[model samples]
Structure formats: structure tokens, C-alpha cells
Target: MFIRIVKMSFHEEKIPLFLDNFHSVKNDIRNFPGNNFLELYQDKNNPSIFFTYSVWNEESDLETYRNSDLFKSVWAYTKAFFNDKPQAWSVDKLESLP
Candidate 1:
């Protein structure tokens, strides 16, 4: 399995728009073929910053999603709300401590 994390810094003024776009994002991924799980997080100290935690069957599944039209549309809208470039990382799921 692959774990993907994305950290985004949103513009204060664009929070509403970003929230609307996130609905679409969530719906899209929820129905995707290889998505395993997803979670959204926010920093208590920084409301404008958010993180997405998602698991996929493989890196190729993520790549396919990223290259899909839905991602393009979502990303184009999403990019406008960022205070800084979004950062992302992918890793192999090695062990679960629990």
C-alpha cells in the first residue's frame, strides 16, 4: 500500500471557495478505484493550513488520479487558494504501530 500526504496553505480570503472545491475533491476520491482511505486535518494553531492523508493501492493508482481530468479541474481551482506551494509526499506503508 501507498500512503500520500499533502500539506496546503490556504489564503485566508479563499477559505470558502476552497471548502466548496474540497467537497468535489472528496466525492471524487471516495469513488476512485484504488483509493483505500482518506482523512483531512487542520492545524489548531493555523486554520489556514491543512493536510490530506490518503492511502492507495499503489503509486500507479495515485499517478492515474493525478493525471486525470478531475484532478486537473480541481487543482486549477485549488491552486488559486494557496498561500504557498502545496507540498506532497508518498511512502510505502511499512508497519502500523497499533
Candidate 2:
């Protein structure tokens, strides 16, 4: 599995507007191919910050989504709200005990 933790900070006064755009992006990505799961969380330390926790079937799955129209549309609107370049990374488990 692949995971991405995306962090975004919106302009404080524009948060409600950002949330509206976020809802749209959330719906678009949810229906994309190879998307296993997705979640959004707010930073306790910083209410202006948001995090996107997502799981993908594979790296290619994410790439496919990234290259799709959904991503393009979502990213275009999302970029306008970014306080900085959002952070994202593909990650995997090194080891797990259960």
C-alpha cells in the first residue's frame, strides 16, 4: 500500500471558502481509480492547518489519479488557498507488529 500525508494551510479569513472547495475536491478524489481510502483532519495546534491522509493501492494508482482531470481541477482551486507549497510524500511500512 502507499500513503500520503498532505498538509495545507489556508488564509485564515478564507477558510470557509477553502472548505467549500475542499468538499468538492474530496468528492472528486473519492471516486478516482485505485483509491483505497481518504481522510481529512484539522491540526489541533493550528486550526488553519489541514491534513489529508490517504491510502492508495500502489504508486501508479496515485500517479494515475494525479494525472486525471479530477486532480487538475482540484489542484487548480486548491493551490489558490495554499499558504505554502503543500507537503506530500509516498510512504510504505518498514515493519509492523500486530
TM-score of each: 0.92, 0.88
Question: Which one is best on TM-score?
Answer: 1
CA deviation > 4 Å runs, candidate 2: 94-98
- Cα lDDT tens digits, model 1, 1-98, are 88999999999999889887787679688678788898889889999999999999989998998998988888888898899989998877678896
Question: Residue 14 deviation, candidate 2, in Å?
Answer: 1.8
The superposed Cα distance between candidate 1 and the true structure at residue 28, in angstroms, equals 1.3
Q: Enumerate clash totals for all models, in the order shown.
A: 0, 0
Q: Where's the lowest-lDDT run of ten residues in candidate 1?
A: 23-32
Tell me the tens digit of each residue's lDDT in model 2 across 11-95: 8887888888778678668767888889999999998899898888888999999898888877887788777778887789688
What lDDT score is found at residue 45 in candidate 2?
Answer: 92
Give the poorly placed runs of model 1, Cα more than 4 Å off.
none
Best by lDDT: 1
| Weakest lDDT window of 10 consecutive positions for candidate 2 | 22-31
